[model samples]
Target: MAAREYGQYCGVTQALELVGERWALLIVRDLLVGPRRYGELAEGLPRIPSNILAARLKELQAAGILRRAPRSRVVVYELTPYGRELEPVVLALGAWGFKAMGDPRDEQVVTPDSMTMALRTAFRPAVAAELPATSYAARLGAAELLVRVDGARLDVSRGDGPVDLSFAAGPGIRRLISGELAPDRAISTGVVEVLHGRGDLLARFATTFHLAA
Candidate 1:
């Protein structure tokens, strides 16, 4: 568990003590997506040292923030009900951190879980409420996602299906989501490549999932 104890008794202090270690909240972040087998988590977090991942998992399990359970005869790790409450906190943190995300480094690679959460963080329910339903199949680096927005609800999943727009982009898609780049410009500049479906919906997709600066 806890790396160290803060002498002061406070809610924030307690919260940090519970999940302050590096990669702890990230474990929670992935589990928030859904249950993941140990190998799945390892694959998603490529940089995490095997021992560190195991240690964090044990710490989180000890804190009751997550648990291991059987799924299709394989054990998977999932957040506990108590841990699910961190969704909003994680989203808020992601938004705050996004302001400092100038660009991705050469070593940084986007994972499906991270991309899913990023889309969730940028999703604009109010704006989407006024737009028609749309679906987008986006491939960012090695991540592929099926994003559907109906009214104010957004559903994101791995893999592909029938979609209004299917495109591929690297990390530059952040510019699109953050409203820094217009859809036409993104397409024209190769920031996004339309593989299938209507390219016009990219504008709608931009409107639906946006984060101001």
Candidate 2:
């Protein structure tokens, strides 16, 4: 007598039925960044109707995938420790989705906070074993991006100064960070414009990580 089942398949289908919805995975992505208020969640994913988001949250809570935090005046959602394990799985799925599908975009609106949060979950440090002594800049939107890949570490900054290569990137920054499009293809095709420095530096820098999802 489980609560969720599309039919009598009753195995993994039960779990899938519980979590499978158009936007369910995104809800988990939002929580992976940090706890968020109901309004905050709405902000992360603007395309989801408020009512639908509410129902999805409730369904996930019932499935033991999410839990509600005690709020004095505002409602907040936090991932249960159980729910946090989903981070890697979702990242891997996203990685595969990007490799299979390439650049992610929909009419669906996604917030900067949510996008940055999602990017961080699958962060690829620009280097494999040692971070570079020199930093790099990428320009996106009105923001000047600062990226430092020191060996195993990544430090991102914001400014329009010379450090290393400069990139004129767009939303596909997600795909680049996830390592879906080979950096070579991305630059050569102008999907990502490297304005300065050595493209080989980035290619060398990009070899460290694979999107495990």
Worst 10 residues of 2 by lDDT: 204-213
- What does candidate 2's lDDT look like per residue over 82-169, in tens digits? 8888878777776666555444455645454444444454455544555445566766544465666667675554445656677676
**What's the true lDDT of residue 28 in model 2?**
89
Per-model TM against the reference: 0.96, 0.65
Per-residue CA lDDT of model 1 for 112-143, tens digit only, reads 99999999999999999999888889898988
Q: What TM-score does structure 1 among the candidates reach?
A: 0.96
The best candidate in terms of lDDT:
1
The lDDT per prediction is 0.91, 0.68
